[model samples]
Target chain A: MATEAQGESGGGLEFHPMDQFIVSPLFGDGGVAWYTITNATLWMALAVAAVFALLVMGTAQRQIIPTRMQSVAELAYGFIYKMVEDICGKDGVKYFPYIMTLFMFIVFSNFLGLLPMAFTPTSHIAVTAVMAFAVFIAVTVLGFVKNGAGFLGLFWVSSAPLPLRPVLALIEVISYFVRPVSHSIRLAGNMMAGHAVIKVFAGFAAIAAIAPLSVVAITAMYGLEVLVSFIQAYVFTILTCVYLKDALHPHH
Target chain B: MATDTHSSAGDGVAAASAPGMPQLDFSTFGNQIFWLVLALIAIYLVLSRMALPRIGAVLAERQGTITNDIAKAEDLNKRAKEAEAAYEQALADARTEAQRIIAETKVGIKQDLDAAIAKADAEIAAKSADAEKAIAEIRAGAMDAVRDVATDTVGEIVTAMGGKADPADLAAAVQARMKG
Candidate 1:
């Protein structure tokens, strides 16, 4: 489908490091109107659908004994509960639902992308940047709402010497701006690296038919990528929590 | 080289814009993201408004049940202690009444035995005194009768036998025989 999209090119385009990062057209132009969905979009949709189905099923019965589905629902609820409580303190409970959705969506998206022929929307810089930007906007808005313009004091630590205040404030502002960049890049980099390594090792399977040694290396890499997927999701969620903490109580 | 590069670029552009080809980043993804966010908002609303309230209600119900159980247990404990105290009081009262009855019965029996014993002792003394008096009277009357009989016999014998006998000596002899 991509070949069809790039119609004339059989294999002429040069591959760059950035090529691994960008999301190109998944299917070439086939006049299907707006009906054509890309693989990334599909996986993303599936993640959303899965989340809905799980939540709906989990809560539909509301049993006292708790069926497996209900338990799964409760587990998710409990996990997010702890996450919010630990990060935002008792007050964090109010935001539990939102944070739970965020964690599940990112985790499911990352895991889904590990499958064969699946596109990781999160692997795209645009997608991650947008998520990061949303978080940034939310945290920023929350800060102002909670602290009013006094939130500006978050950047200027009065504890610093009077002479160093301006410089420290500048640094703080720069760091604050860098939050979204780092947040987005962290997720994007981890996802792209994992997918690239997996693709490279998988490519070796074609050659491993001739060179048996490549099989062992491919197996090890596949195992490593699997571990990496879970770790990336954890890292993403934890960093999100830490960022939210800074927003909730900005100081050091 | 310029011509080759230009013609290939032209070909690439032509391929990219071919009929029935949709443009990349044509807001398709943007629309999807928008819908996804909207759906997310809807889910969040439902959870917060419906599901969350129900969960909270269940938890509150559980807490209420626990509280009621504790309260009931405490009430039962209080009742049990009261009953135990009442039972002990009843037991003590019964013990006191039994002791009183036993002592009263012992005293009553002792009184009846002492009264009967005193009455029998008095009767035996009275009968012994009367027998002594009666015996004395009998002795006196017998003595008198015996004297008369002796006198008459002595007189008759003296006359027949031609021997003299004195009245005083005969009486003395009779009396002496009686004394022996």
Candidate 2:
């Protein structure tokens, strides 16, 4: 849909890099309501299906000696499990399933989005914002519940001198509130930026003189995006663990 | 060309008002969020309910299997060591028993030899004593027979020479001669 821009009209070179992110209805040229199945839904569904195929059906045998898919499933399990345990400590292991869910969803969505003409759900601020806010809210509530009034100690800056504690506390509070915003934006920004750059480069291929350079740029950007996709997912998961750690033990 | 440019310029303004960045379009946020929440929930359910527990069990089972195999191997090794010790003890016991028997047999043979040697020595001493007594008796008998022969020879000579008055006188002469 985006590449079909002004092909018949022999006008100036047209470039609509951001057009790929449009959330149009899959069935028709209609409006996108909250429950409507758009390209976003299709990709999200694909990501879910991919998760099921990898983790669920792949480990159906539950063998001591694992198959390739089973091994990968186990690796993903172990990687996230270790991450949760390390950042959040052993006590934080209870929340491992939630962290794994976020990691697998983002990672899969990212990798799947690498396919040609595919929509990246994680690239959207709305999607990333919701997940980040969910994590933030959950961690905050857990901190309060687990530690009671002591959870506010996260912002109290007990390590500082008593005179400096108030200022430090204010700064900590601001930073604490900003965590979800930064967390969501970081992922969404990285994914969106890489994809947009690649699209911009792809648009330049309309010129016969610089087609090779554009292709090369696209290739490099595509490779970087692949790395970015996984890393962004990883950063998101690790940050969640960090937040969870703070909730579990907010003193330090 | 002028008409085309004007039309394109109007389209650009329209596009700008609608916004080129789809991410900034607030109208679609609800839709994206709704689908994302649904996807996350689906992923969460599938993972927590089915996949994770199975993977965990398989990992746990593999660990347990390894531990059990190692334990079994160690147990067998201990049993083997015990068997070797038992065999060595049996061998040592047999050797001791044989040594004791040999010592007893040697002692018995020595005792029997001493007894035989003592009995033969005593018999030899007794025979030597009896032979010495018989030799003294034979010497005495020889002396008596010599005296009788001398006396008879003197009597016959005296009778022949007609110088003897009686046999008693001749006996007396022989006895005197034997005594000198």
Candidate 3:
């Protein structure tokens, strides 16, 4: 800590982008237990509260001619509902609640993380990986439960030549396994990268001569981060729908 | 400003040795993942139980309302169109009735005028026939009176000449002169 302060005093640029991402205890400083109520818990609870505020309390009145908040809620419902129905078909609509949960949480986390001095839960590999693995495991189980032995058809490319089918199937199986990794990493990486870039640019603002340009870069990156936040949530939800589609109709 | 912000923000977790990437710090994975699962579960429960159904119902109700309103509007439009059609029908009926009445009146007037002309023609023909009969009778009477005068003059001439003439012969001579 003294060295960081010393580094700052020496007129060197300070970059603590990961400090914002650290999952430390909200109260006393110690090892983070599994049950510890850390900043991650606060922010996660905030995400839950946000979801509840918007989805539950915001639409409590349930007016036919909606208020602005209710309209936003309805828009979100329609958007995710249509995605599930479109990608996974009508049968997939049953899972709309689950997909919607993931979307709302991730989206809220990303946006809330954009707030100054806020921790991004989605930026952590552990959090996103848990979600991605949950989806992967659930979809796999659902596929096998629904299709039995036919669930393996997801790997077997019937359209390819009989000789090439084996090679294609190998690649397909590997990619199938990689879905969770890519899914989790894609979100976490985008969040981490954008935020880290913003922090780096913010660090550059310590230079008096380039402060204006750094501020401009941060502003631009912030705008792009806002877009990425929503888009990542959308992509995650859509991919979940796609995976669910594969589970429901594994033959295709 | 940047140093102040970085130091203050960093002071929260500066107690722990700062990892290059906090995301890879497996020590905190349990905490983040556990909270994330809790949040996800909480959100899922909230959405599935209360929020989703309410929003779904509201959307459906709104759709129903919009559909009902549109249907009502369409019904009103249909009714309006029917009313206009009925109005046009009534107007046509009135025009047809008026034309029929005018045609009927014209027929009646033409019939009455024809009957009056026929009656006048018949009355004038009867009057002329009666007048011709009277004139014919007067003309016959005038011829008879002339013949009679001729006969009397023949008789007087015979008497003044002192000739013993037969009455029949005189009469025959008068008749012949008159015939000529």
Q: Report the lDDT tens digits of candidate 2 across residue range B1-180.
A: 244333334444434555566677777889999889899999989988999998999889989999999999999999999999999999999999999999999999988988888888898889888888888888888877887787778777777797765767767877888789
Better of 1 and 2 by DockQ: 2
lDDT of 3 by residue, A130-168 (tens): 999999999999999999999999999888889999999
**Runs off by more than 4 Å, candidate 3:** A1-10, B1-19, B120-180
* Order by lDDT, highest first: 3, 2, 1
Q: On residues A1-252, what C-alpha lDDT tens digit does candidate 1 reach at each position?
A: 353335335343321212232223346633223344544556777777766666665667766666786667666666766777898778767777767666667777777777765667677655677778888899899988887887788898899999999999999999999999998888877887777665555444555363466567667766776787667767766677776777677765
State the lDDT at B56 in candidate 2. Answer: 91
DockQ of structure 3: 0.46
Show pairs that collide, candidate 1.
A5-A28, A29-B21
lDDT of 2 by residue, A59-172 (tens): 998888899999999999999999998888999998999999999999999999899888898988989999999999999999999999999999998788999999999999
lDDT of 2 at A181: 99
Of 2 and 3, the candidate ranking higher by DockQ = 3
Q: Once all C-alphas are superposed, what RMSD does model 2 give against the true structure?
A: 7.3
Query: Alpha carbon lDDT of residue A194, candidate 1?
Result: 73
lDDT (Cα, tens digit) per residue for candidate 3, span B150-176: 777777887889876787887788788
Name the TM-score of candidate 1.
0.60
lDDT of 2 at B1: 29
By DockQ, rank the candidates, best first: 3, 2, 1
Judge candidate 1 against the unseen true structure and give its global Cα lDDT, from 0 to 1.
0.66
Rank list by TM-score: 3, 2, 1
